[model samples]
Target: MGVVERTWSWLATGAHWSGPDGVWHRLGEHLFLTAVCLAISCAIALPVAVLLGHLGKGGALAVNISNAGRAVPTFAVLVLLLLSPLGTHGSWPTVIALVLFAIPPLLTNAYVGMREVDRDVVEAARGMGMTGRQLIARVELPLAFPLIVTGVRTAAVQVVATTTLAALPGGGGLGRIITAGFRLTDTAQVVAGAVLVAALALLVEGVLMLAERLFDPVRRRTGPVPG
Candidate 1:
């Protein structure tokens, strides 16, 4: 009860958004944290997915690993990470956890996209003396771009949501608002924090949608997804 009262008092006065370091101060951190995790995921997942999809190897194993990653609830991941070398003591745990969470979509999409590319087109590309790298960069990836972008889009949304979990371990993000509200049992505070998180997720989705359009010529011809 005291916690709730205190939380509301702070919120009513806008203290939640204006505390030392404050909501505005940490907004950048939240975006930065999400972006960093996503960038790292792409760096590893793209190459691995492309190669795995092209070779048609270890796919079951890879998907299984990614699915298992999803089962390890985000909060549990954060708690376990805190117990390890990459915990409240450091930021790497959140990075590692988010990367794990981001990989499945990428791996699945890459494999599916490459497999779905017209085999005849691939043969033509090869028949024309296109090298493996050339086929992938020119023929495969472009056609695969929309689906691949879909994976990135999914990853971005997921990362933004999971980032709040990272806050529980003191890694810092908008989750701080959520956890603080929970500790205080303040409904308004909780709502305020939740509202911000939802807004951020929508913003990320919009940006990714734009990215998909800008890169996917096929999409341009077909038109945007029905909202």
Candidate 2:
């Protein structure tokens, strides 16, 4: 049978969807790792991006440094991390590597979004005696909301795809299914695993896109209200 047919058959197998090493368990592990890493990346990147973007000070330098991190390969970082003391901590190296990979887009998009808010509107808000905190909360952030959500969506999908790397370190994730298939020379299993990862990434992208539209403050304000 062709790889495609075998992959469909493999995915259809109920036995592969249950148990410790099954698809569901691996999917859960993949999601947990993505969530944790995305959360950590946001925590580390957002406040700094917001503050710098708000002040309009030191933002360029900070953004440049963060963007520079993108050139570093995540797998190399993971390997180096595994060779260090962190190697003993299950999943930390993987988590750390994913977090690092996720940060640049969040920081860059947020900073650019904030900086792109209408300067005239900001001046008008300031003219009305709006304080720094007030301007950020009431003006800049709401205006930048869509772009920030875009950054989040981008990061989430990237993390989902990348979390498969976790299996390389003997950590749990969908990648393990692929690696297992490789070890056993089962092309069908490998194809199924790849399909699962792609489906998950697309699922995340779709959900976040819906969220972006629903929660966009500008759109809500400008859009028609229900009668």
Candidate 3:
């Protein structure tokens, strides 16, 4: 009964918005925080993953470390950061915490993807006079791109959902509503916030699918894709 009520309440969230401006403004803030955290996490993770992958050393060790990172509770990490240099009171700090939450997936995907690129392909490129950068840009990254896209897709969804944790720091998101709902015992608002989060997840997943298709080298190799 609680679950059904929650779902119905979520469905009805949109009707409670006071005006177009308020609705768009709040949603826009949510998106801004989500994008910022996502971008920061990917930027930091990709290069490190690629470098480690290219080194072809410590692959298993690196993966285990990331696994540990994923294992540690995100809320614990966030509280620690808030107490330290992160200060925990600002939106950017919340963004930072979310980025930390996002790192394991992005790092694991990029590193593992590049590592999985066929060794023969790397050797062939080397034999053909490809430089280090050329080997990466043309050969390894291309092959690994599919896996990388999968990582980004996973990260996108995870980041969007996790950004709700930003509410702990007074950052805007559906979490803001959820927090308010918790304090007020307003299950309707809680359900509404959860609904917005689910919708946002779906929207994020759709956009990333388009990105994955666009970047897929396998599709490019097969034929000219329609614009």
Highest lDDT against the true fold, candidate:
2
Please give, for residues 60-155, the per-residue lDDT of candidate 2 as tens digits: 676786668777876778789999999999889899988988888898889889999999999999999999999999999999898888998998
Candidate 3 per-residue lDDT over residues 86-157, each given as its tens digit: 574576567777887778888888889999999998999999999988888888888999888888889889
Question: What stretches of model 3 exceed 4 Å from their correct place?
Answer: 1-15, 18-23, 224-227
TM-score of each: 0.86, 0.95, 0.85
Tell me each candidate's RMSD, in Å, in order: 3.6, 2.1, 3.6
Candidate 3 collision pairs:
none
Model 2 clashing residue pairs (backbone): none
Clashes of 3: 0
Q: Which stretches of candidate 2 lie above 4 Å from their native place?
A: 224-227
Which sections of candidate 1 miss by over 4 Å?
Answer: 1-15, 19-21, 219-227
* Candidate 1 accuracy as TM-score: 0.86
Worst 10 residues of 2 by lDDT: 58-67
